[model samples]
Target chain A: MENPCIICVAITGSLPTKANNPAVPVTVAEQVESTQEAFEAGATICHAHVRNDDETPSADPEKFARLKEGLEEHCPGMVIQFSTGGRSGAGKARGGMLSLAPDMASLSVGSNNFPTRVYENPPELVDWLASEMLEYGVKPEVEAFDLSHILKAADMHKKGQIKDTPYVQFVMGVKNAMPVDREVFDFYIKTVKRLFGEDAAWCAAGIGAQQVVLNEWAISSGGHART
Target chain B: MENPCIICVAITGSLPTKANNPAVPVTVAEQVESTQEAFEAGATICHAHVRNDDETPSADPEKFARLKEGLEEHCPGMVIQFSTGGRSGAGKARGGMLSLAPDMASLSVGSNNFPTRVYENPPELVDWLASEMLEYGVKPEVEAFDLSHILKAADMHKKGQIKDTPYVQFVMGVKNAMPVDREVFDFYIKTVKRLFGEDAAWCAAGIGAQQVVLNEWAISSGGHART
Candidate 1:
């Protein structure tokens, strides 16, 4: 039984702020330090989103460059992936950091409801983000909030919008998105294997306290676990 | 196996027009006549969206009232369902005609991608639509565009948002939305039975050329078909 596991660390996502946790890293310097520490703790992938000084989200490529520089200096051999999610920025700004050409970038292939609003990854926007990822030589971890999204990723791969086998990440327990049902969890794993192939790697994520549940599901099921 | 299938006719959806089909029924008179003909042809439910004189979609309750009156007059005893869909209007306007207290209204419980953009039914909007349906004593045909919507409908039913066992409709073959997939189709049926009840009525809809396929699938599978 080959049970090698990949540990991915998402330091700062779009929603969490300093108010949510005093330890939440917002500034580029803080993010770099946080990634360095996470990498030292055996995190192979450092997934990051840059924020402004006032704790507001920012898509500035300069900040990403600085963080990338610091991570290279402090945590060599770490896979750096930028977040192209909707909350950080609107439209093309979400993908502005992709030009820095990190090892990977998160790409949501379809639209689903967030807690408060629609997480809109329109067809053109999804196509544009995939193109940018391709241009920057970055791999996309297709964020699957729903089953259709995994199918959408397959459609994109067939159209050559996504270059490699889409490394899918199942996002569950979001307020209005998919929930953490055991049947759905098992079904997601089956669908991913059916779509991408049995050998392709995948991951699962859950918001807030349910994160541990998804982590256990992914790790125990022979898939990657994201924190 | 006594499978008595319900036949629902969608006379004028938000998108189709006189350009798409010369007999699209723009005015209330046209809709009334068209419903009469469809009813005469053995359609049990008349699922309709009112249009203005120029064939533009309208959420005006006055037109809906007129259409309702005419439908009752012409197609006696036929179930009338209004479209509370986004293309007809924005925000509260989608549910404006629910006050007419038609037998049913189409309600999308979750958001998913449409042909070109996101079909945004935010949580608040979904709540509002469900509440409006409850207030008006109108049953909701839960429009399940994606897998989560069927689950969302279950949640709503448990929470008393939907008064009756939800009748879910599987919408497939939309451009960027859920495409027509057989495995997904079978899973949708299983999900509806698991969530609502084993005997809960369900329907299937396929866009354009695939409508016949969905009709055959639904009819053979003991579910309703939407035309």
Candidate 2:
């Protein structure tokens, strides 16, 4: 038996602009081109967030549609995942693009502290996003910022809110949130396996400079990695 | 060597009015009397929240001051801890009672989802509350609603934001939050001991019906219990 690796590339995050990194892609065309390049380099997943003309984060469904079209045309078969993260929008606006029915969408099941503020994912908003994903036949990639999020995903799955087995992705190294700790990383994997299953598909991503460390750990542990 | 057990009693929580239970105390006088009874019944710590005449939660310092005076007079030598929980107030108003200089105050170092909403403890607000506790010589009983909160308490203690070693309380069984799970509870205790010290004092609280389970776990593990 052989196991295949899934490499996910985040072309543009909700944060970061040309000011932060000159190579960071902002526009739809730039994101598509960059993601296509990454897709050609063994990247099978593209996690994306759109930006406004002034390089600010935007939850505009129109922008998401354009980006989705470009990615489908340029990087065929690459998993396109839209971010329903709080950074891009507030309230229901965050799930506006779920109707596009991307291959997968990031769903935060619980709230946690971020670098400078609370990453507010209220229960109602979480349920609403999960419902939207179910409506559009979008697979939810549960973003586990903390331990309870994994459990919350399990509870949501039991309640028929999340369709299919939840693909959980552990996020670590955010200031005031879960920091980069090997023991915690191990516990997250253990908990995911315990709740989801032994052969459950799980992934991990570390923020900023710690990304490479998480990638190494995930690959070595026979799990997926998101950069 | 004898390990003394500290039983903390929450006389008046932010939620649960007379409608929920006829014995639920709302007025300051009722709170003092209820806490006095609990204190005499082996509960050495009084965790309290003030309520308005309409049974709504209030963060008024005057009400807190009155409660403080009554607790000191009625339940002398018993620890008086104010609740800075989100249900009672928002932003700096949550820490308004720190000026009263109670023995201890509850501090949520990170955010998590509540039953209906996101318990919004923003980074700035958490820092400000910790600073207020430090300034007023009030010991903060860090509320560990989720795993990262315990780690955050350690980080705050290292940075001098928390004046002393944190007394972290694991709060479980809340809807949409960390539920009462034995594995998770054990891991919480392990994490606290790893981050703080092996001899560090810890406590656990379970919402609603699971309170007895958590109390048993805490007592058997040589930790404290909060009711």
Of the candidates shown, which would achieve the greatest lDDT relative to the real structure? 2
Model 2 lDDT per residue over B1-227, tens place: 38899999988788898989999999999999999899889899999999999999999999999999998898889999999999988889999889999999999999998899888999999999998998999999999999989889999999999987889999999999999999999999999889889999999999999999999999999899999
For residues A1-227, what per-residue lDDT tens digits would candidate 2 score against the true structure? 27899999988898898999999999999999999999999999999999999999999999999999999999999999999999899999999999989999999999998888888988998989999999999999999889999999999989899878889999999998999889999999899889888999999999999999999999999789999
Classify candidate 2 by CAPRI docking class: high
Cα deviation of B50 in candidate 1 (Å)? 1.0
Two-chain DockQ for model 2: 0.90
Off by over 4 Å in 1: A1-3, B1-3
lDDT of 1 by residue, B68-125 (tens): 9999999999999999999988998899888889999999988888878888898999
Candidate 2 residue spans exceeding 4 A from truth:
none
